[model samples]
Target: MFLKNAWYVAGWDSELVGDALLARRLLGTNVVFYRGEDGTPVALEDRCCHRLAPLSHGQREGNCVRCMYHGLLFDATGRCVDVPGQERISDKLRVRSYPLVERDHLLWIWMGEPSLADPAQIHDSHWHDAPGWTAERGGYIHYKSNVHLITDNLLDFSHLAFVHNKSIGTRKQGGVKPEVTFSEESVSVRFTTIEGAPPPFARQLSKLPDLVDRFNFYVWNIRGNYFAQDSVIAPPGDGYGSQSPLAMKLHTFIALTPADEGSSHYFWSTAHNDFTTDIVDVTRQLTAQVTAAFEEDRNIIEAQQRSIDASPGAPMIAIAADGTLLRIRRMVDGMAAAEQARPVEQTLVFQPAARV
Candidate 1:
C-alpha cells in the first residue's frame, strides 16, 4: 500500500540485458519489459493483440517482441510493427507502453500515470552511491501478504528479540526495551545491545571481529543516511530464528513493490564499509541467508492470509509487538483511501504533457 506514484525497484541492474523480454508484475499490473536498440529499457502491457498470450513468452527480435503464438511483432513503443499474415491494422490495436529507466544498478518502471513518472523521485540511499561502501545487490522471495506488511516489518526493530533471536538477538539483550518514535512517513526505533563478544548468531560472522558490540538499528520511510545498531528483527516461522548482530552492521537497502492483490516483489542491496574488498562475495552469501529468512516469512504470511480468508468475519487479536504492523496497516489504508478519492484523471505520471 505504499505510494503507487513513487518509483520502486523492479530488478537488479544486471538482470536487464540485450533484447530480453522480462515479465514482471508492478502496481497490480502484469508488465512486459525489454531493452531497445538504443539500450534503453521499455515496458508494455504483457498481453498481445493477436492472441491473449503474454508478450513475455514471445521472442525478442531486434528491440521488438514477436508474439510466439501469432508472430505479431511490437516495438518498444508498443506499436505493432510486423503482422505476419495481415498487412494492416488500426492504430487502436497497439499495446500500452509504460516509461522505464535504469539507475544505480536497478530497473525502475512507471506503473501509475506515465505523465507523473519522475525518475528522480525514486529513493536511492547514499551508501549505495558512496565511494567507500561496496554494494551487493539482488532480490528476495515474493510474499503473499500485502506490500504494506513488508514495509511494516522493515520499520519495526523490536521483533529481533523473540522472532529473530537466533540470527540477531542475544538472550541477554532481549530484556532491553526499545524507545520507538514515528513520523508521518517514517518510523524510528532505537535500542541498545550488550557490547563486546559475539552472541550465538555471531558465530557465523567470526570473520568480522570489529562488528561485535552494542548496535543501533534505524528505519526511515522517506530517504536519508543514518546508522543504528543492528537489532532489527523480522518475524520467524520456519525455525530459522534471527540473524547474527554482525550481519546488521552490513547496511541493507530494501524496496518493496506490489505485484498484485496477494503478491509483491522485494528487491534489496547490501553494503558495508569493512567488506569493501569482498562485498560481492559477502553479498552472495548474505543474499542466500537473507533469502532463506524471507522464505520463512513467505510461508507464514501465506498461511496467515489463508486463515484470514477462511474466517473473514472472525475477530483478530494483537499484542505489543504488533504495534508496528498496526501502524503500517493504518498508513496503507489511508493511502488507499486518498488514492480512491482522487479522480483517475489525476493519477501520478512519469512524464507530464506540456501545458497549453
Candidate 2:
C-alpha cells in the first residue's frame, strides 16, 4: 500500500559525510547508498544480481561496487562492468539504480518506476536553509510504527494535551477549534488560541504578556511530512494573524520519512527570525524538551501499532477534528491506488530486452 512514484527522504546528507555504505529498508526494498569520489551519492539494490549477495557487505572500488560473493563489479549506474575470470559482460547483469537527489542537506530517493521520477516534484523543505533564518540542531529519530500512523498523529494535534503536557502543551490548545483546509497538493490543519497562555516552556523567555495569540499548525503534502508551531504574540485584543515588528515570534519545523511498514524515520529542525532572541534561544537550547514531546508521540504511536498489528482490520473511528487526517489518508491511498492500477501497456513498454 505504498506509493512508488514519490520521493522519500533516504537520510540526512550528514549521515553520508564519509565514504561509507549506508544500508536502509525503504518501503520494503533494501537499498544500499554510498558516495563516489566525485562526491555524488549513488543508490542501488542491495542484493547482487548474480548470487543475491548484499552489496552493502561488499567493497567499493572507486565509484563502483564489487560484489565479493562472486567478484561481480557494478558501476555507479548499476551496470555490470566486469566479472572475474570472464571477458563477456551481459547488459542484463545489473541491479536497480534508484534515482537520488540531494537538496537542502537531505537525501531524497525515488523508489518507483525510474522513468517517472522527477526531481522537480521533490517537496521543497527549504525552510531549513531559507535566507534570513537560522535553522538549528537538525535531529533524526527512528520509530517503530507505520508511517501513516505517525502522519495521522501529526494531522491532528489535539493529542498534545495528554501527550506533551509537561513539555509544550497547555490545556488551552485542547479547546481551540482548528481550521482545516485542503487542495490537490496538500492539507493543512491550524489551531489558533487567542489571548490564551502560551505553552509553559515558551512563556519563560517570551516578552509576550500573559494573554497573547499563538497557533499550532500541521501540513501534509504529496511526498513529505510537514508541520509547524508558530507564535506571533500580539496583545489579546489588539489584533490577530498579522505580524508586528515588535512582536515576539516562534517557528518550528518537523518532517518525517518512512523506512518500512513497521518502522519509520523522523527528521526535524527549528528555525526562527530575529524578533525574539530570548524566546528562540530557549527553543534552541531546550531541544531536549522538544525531543521529549516527540518521544511521547512515539510511545503512543508504537502502542497503537501493536494494537493495529493484532487487529489490522479493526475499525477506528474518526471525529469532527479528523477531517484533515481523513483527507490526508484518502490522498495517499488514492495515489497508491492509481499507481497500482497503472496500465499494463505503459509498464510493458519499459520492460527489459530479451536475452541474446
Candidate 3:
C-alpha cells in the first residue's frame, strides 16, 4: 500500500457532480462523493453512522445525504442534521468526512488522520500547472487487485515483452539493458530497443520526433516524474494467464487506490504530444484500449490474491528480470515502514473548502 500522506488519484473531476452519490476509494478507505448546495465537492465515509448502510446507496438531498435506512441526514462536513421519527438526536452525532480536492482532472482525497490534510503536501509538479505540456484527461478503471500489485506493475516495464507483445512489444526488444537510477522518493529506468526496433503500434507514433526504425524507446516513468524503462517480468500470481492487451498505447498512466484490503481501484490516463489537435478522439481510443488491458490484468491479479489468501507464507522465486520489481517492493515496504515509524502529527485549522 502507498503512504497515507501521499496523494492517490480517486476519480476524474467530471464524475463528482450532480445530486448523485459517487462511491470511490482512497488510501484503502471507501468514500462517498457528492456536491453540496453550493456546488462544492464533499466526501464522507460511504457507510452511514447509524446502521452502516452505504450513504451512496441513498439519495442526495440538497447538499446532504439522506440515509434511506433511517432517514439520517449528513451534511458536507458530515454533521448529522436530522433523525427522522426521533424527537431529538445528539448534536455530537456525526459521520467521518474526508477533505477532497479536484486537480488536473483527478480527484484527490486526504485519507490520513484528518488533522494532516494539507493540499500543499500533495505532489502536483507535473500535471498541475506546467508550461509546454498539453494533457487530455478523462475517467479511470476499477480493478480487483491489491493496489500494491498495480503499483508494482507500473514501476516495472519488462511486462511489455510478453503481456503486451501484440500491442507494444517486439521480438528484438527481449534483451535487457536498462539504465536505473533512484532517489529517496522515487526510481527511474530507461531502455532502448535497437534490434526488435518498433512494434506495430510504433507505426502510428512514427510521425513523432526522435523515433526511428532501428531505435525504439521504452520508458517506464514512475513516481512524481521518476522515469525508468527496463525489461522486468512482474511477479507471477495465480488465477489469470497473461494474454491479450487491454490498454491502447505504451505511455499510459496506471494509478492504484486500495478500495479495501483485498481490492483496488485502478485509474489510468494518457498524455502525448502527437494527439493535441484531436484530443477527444485520442482520449476515447486510448480509454478503450486501456480498459481492455485493465481487464487482462484484473483476471491475473484477482487470481494471485486468491492464491495468497490460500497460502499465507509461500515463498516465490525471482530472476534477473525482476530487479525493478524487487526495487519497487522494497521502496513501497520502506515507505510503509517509515510511515508507521514516524507518524505525521495532525493539526486542524479552520480554512474554507475550495469551491470546485
Model 2 lDDT-worst window of ten? 347-356
lDDT of 1 by residue, 93-183 (tens): 6777776667767776666556667666655555667785666666556777776556655655555455555554555565666666777
lDDT of 1: 0.62
Ranking by TM-score: 2, 1, 3
Which candidate gets the maximum lDDT versus the true structure? 2
Estimate, for each residue in 243-301, the C-alpha lDDT of model 2 and write its tens digit. 65535554666666677788988877776555553554564555666677788899999
For lDDT, candidate 2 versus 3, the one ahead is: 2
TM-scores vs. true structure, each candidate: 0.78, 0.88, 0.76
Candidate models: Cα lDDT each: 0.62, 0.74, 0.60
Clashes of each: 20, 0, 14
Model 2 clash pairs are none
Candidate 2's C-alpha runs over 4 A off are 225-251, 275-283, 344-356
Q: Please provide, for model 3 over 8-68, each residue's C-alpha lDDT reduced to its tens digit, 9 standing for 90 to 100.
A: 6667768866787898766666688887777777778888878989898888998788999
